[model samples]
Target: MKKHVAWHIVRACLLPAVLFSSRALADCAQDFARDNAYKPHAGAHRMHERKLPLSLLDGQWVPTLKQEIINTISEVVPPNATRITSDGLFGPIGLVVIGDRGWIRANGDAAWEPLNAAESKEILDGAFTSYLSFNRMSDLSCTRAEHNGRPARVYHYKMPSELQIGSHSEITAYFDDQTGLPVHVEVEDGNPRQRAKSTVSIAFDSAIAIQPPETAGQTPRAGNADPSGRRKSLYKHPPGEAL
Candidate 1:
């Protein structure tokens, strides 16, 4: 399989921080907006996600990357610092971001490589925009429901063509009514050849410190000067899609 290495890292670590799909409903819009405004001083998040590809004949979902499973633990400190550890389809990966600078390491490597401008832009620019940006999609519907026995709001919407990964893509999201926080999200994308689906669940921690990992060296990876060159990533975000 052809892996979009950089895309994977971007998705595996940061995508869970951005979730949900919505538009139209005034209450949903307001609630989702509040979620976007949330930026806690310190906390930790745990996410688990599974992805599968669909077969044409029977519409059965099959494992494309050997039943890819992504588990991430992200911790944040004051002043926007974050450290994410992810066990992705490829292996283990880590990312750290402090202000405008970030570093990435893969496969339990000791050294952390700093992200270049273009690469950093690609990963961070939209990493947290999905929920806020999806409000632009034209057709969105919402309903009130219960999740985990708590009041919740549900939203289902199709991604805009420009943001789609395949012939079409759709998302369903659940938000906590009391807290205005996203609890779960599901996404499905497909084309004539195959279909893909990803589901993620989130949990938060009240206290955690996000610090850079100690490493022996900081040498750059060969061939990475070219942004398009093959490398590595984990969560596997598709190109051209909104985070």
Candidate 2:
């Protein structure tokens, strides 16, 4: 899948932020200052993301759109694999990638069709870099909070307008208090044409591994998926090829 598409998928699974008291805000700001100084190691992580549709009502955004038709599910396995399922005209459609090779299939379809060379290249080029992008953030606000009964730090910030999906966005991120690693993220953006909300849940050191799907529910054609059909292939395109 392309980077933009993968990014959209990654945006799917997050929770909206809630306000906290002034005392909690002070502690959160202190935590942000300290945590932002050190980079924590988040090795071989996975994510489940979902995007929700929104509508405008009385000058506010609400999740009142056709929920059934406006949902997307995404799974990520860094540094080179992602799978996304979204509502399609017919039904749910699925796209998956492991390294340079990938597959696609509609809901209820038995066979997983292989992606073309062009798409495979996009998948390889669009591999995820990091779960969080904390560099050069602006208009930062934070609060101490609890997520699932555990101590949490929630940050509300504005990214550079040029870097946001729309002209502006409201971004909220939840981090583990002790680890300083991200746990969930929510991004809501609006423009004259459309409005969107997305959430993502991050899991560090996930044991679930992404593998290439079998074509037609049958075994992979031997030697086509890397030298061995079972192992992952971290294939890189030759330089100067079409991206």
Q: Provide the overall lDDT of each model, using Cα atoms, as 2-decimal numbers.
A: 0.55, 0.54
Rate residue 200 of model 2 by lDDT: 70
**Candidate 2, pairs of clashing residues:** 12-50, 12-51, 12-199, 13-49, 13-50, 13-199, 13-200, 14-199, 14-200
How well is each residue in 11-127 modelled by candidate 2, as lDDT tens digits? 322111223234335655566555533233454555455665444556765553333234555555656677766663223556777776777664423246677666755544433
Best by lDDT: 1
Candidate 1, residue 113: lDDT: 69
Show model 1 residue runs off by greater than 4 Å: 1-4, 7-27, 41-44, 55-60, 72-78, 106-111, 116-136, 160-166, 216-243
Evaluated against the true structure, the overall lDDT of model 2 is 0.54
How do the residues 1-243 of candidate 1 rate in per-residue lDDT, one tens digit apiece? 112453465553454333444343477656555664534532445445555644454454444433354455555454445666766543466777765777777644335767666655545444433322362343466788998999988877666432234344687778888877777888777766456777867666656565655662466445334322232232233322211
